[model samples]
Target: MGFSVRALDTDSWAAFAELVEANNGVWGGCWCMGFHVKLGKGRTAQQNREEKEARVQTGDTHAALVFEAEKCLGWCQFGSPDELPEVKSRRLYEKGLTTLPDWRITCFFTGKGFRGRGVADAALGGALAQIAQYGGGVVEGYPEETDDRKVSGSFLHTGPMSAFENHGFTRTRPISPHRWVVTRTV
Candidate 1:
């Protein structure tokens, strides 16, 4: 089964929302906003949805959304450091971070019933293609390594390290146990 990729913008917001909504707003209503901004106290699912839509409307966010004939399969969110400043393991990442890359791949989602079907690979490939279209540069991704362990799909939102390696990203350093910073020139 092949899937097509599209940029996340006003035109594809509905489809993106559909995927997230079907998954109960994703990450407990994160809407994949975990990297974009800090959803502090008083943040609601509706707020996240609205904020994400607002960002999409103003071109403040970017992602490669995968679809199988109009139904969204999943997405891989990528953006500039400024666009997405709040990353997981912030302290550890900053400790090893010398400089920021041109782009950062922070989030990914492979819809329910579609896990392990290469959706992540497709979404990742699509993201790189889109980044190239936006002017290729150094790209970085933080992914967990699931070499011989069973990790719940729900917790692998940042994607698997193996996928990044398959996409030409070399391991840079380990930020946490089982998680590494992967980089590619793109």
Candidate 2:
């Protein structure tokens, strides 16, 4: 079956929640809040879950959820820097960040048993399209390059460099050993 994409609003919360629950609250109780202001530090999984759910209800969080037959397979999380300020290699990132993009693709999550099936790509495409609908502007993402060696999927929540490049994002700067700040005007 073909994949479908939807905005992560109240209506899609159940599906998104199911995916997170299945993944053990996602990367140890993150609920995809690692980049959000909350950070979920010293918080319980249920606490993070509740916080994320509340944000979803109020339409504060943003993501493109990819689904197959009513089961959400994955998602690409994106929002303004204000909405998602926390990031890896923060010091290096701020040093070279000349201007913040209108939207930032913070991370991605593919459901178990659905990896390597183009879910992340679909989520990325859906996110850029949605960003355009909201008035297109520059978009940014931090993705790792895996040209010389293989990187585990679990460590790729930020996404892969190739996916952004495929969507027209260019290599702007490097923040970590393998991760780089990539951008494109969506």
Candidate 3:
């Protein structure tokens, strides 16, 4: 069957959370909020999870999820400009990174059993098309590119270089040796 995508809603949070934890547990509990939320000062992992869920529920329709038939297969985080403080607050921003008023693609997670079936690519394509439906502007993705010889889940939260590039994203800047800022101007 074909892969389909939609914005994650409150009703689907359980499945979404499950996908995150299941993948994160084996990959290390990144929780997908490691860089986005402050989990250090005093908050615990559980608290961070709650906060992220709350944000997902109350925040604008930003995050997109993919499904194949009845199974949730992948997810891609996207939304308006200010929704991603983690990326905006980075040192790269201070160094003159351009900002678009539309949405940005920040994180991606393809479920354990659905990694290499073109799930991520299909989800990303669906996300871009969905956002564009409402006049979404340029889409940006900053994925990490670790040595292919030693690749693993932990090394790819933002995504991989070839994935974004294949989806029409071009390298805008090198955020790090492994991470790069990519953009597709609409």
Q: Give the top-scoring candidate (TM-score).
A: 1
Go through the candidates in order and give each one's C-alpha lDDT. 0.91, 0.91, 0.72
TM agreement with the true structure for every prediction: 0.97, 0.96, 0.83
Candidates arranged by TM-score, highest first: 1, 2, 3
lDDT of 3 by residue, 7-95 (tens): 77787677777787776632355555654654456656676677677777785545668887667788877776566656733786447
> Tens-digit lDDT track for model 2 on 145-166?
8886988987689999989999
**What does the lDDT read for residue 35 in candidate 1?**
91
Ten contiguous residues with the weakest lDDT in model 3: 25-34
Q: Which sections of candidate 2 miss by over 4 Å?
A: 38-41
Cα lDDT tens digits, model 1, 1-186, are 778999999999999999899999998899888898898788999999999999999999999999999989999999999999988888999999999999999989987888778999999999999999999899999999998899987658888998999999999999888888999997
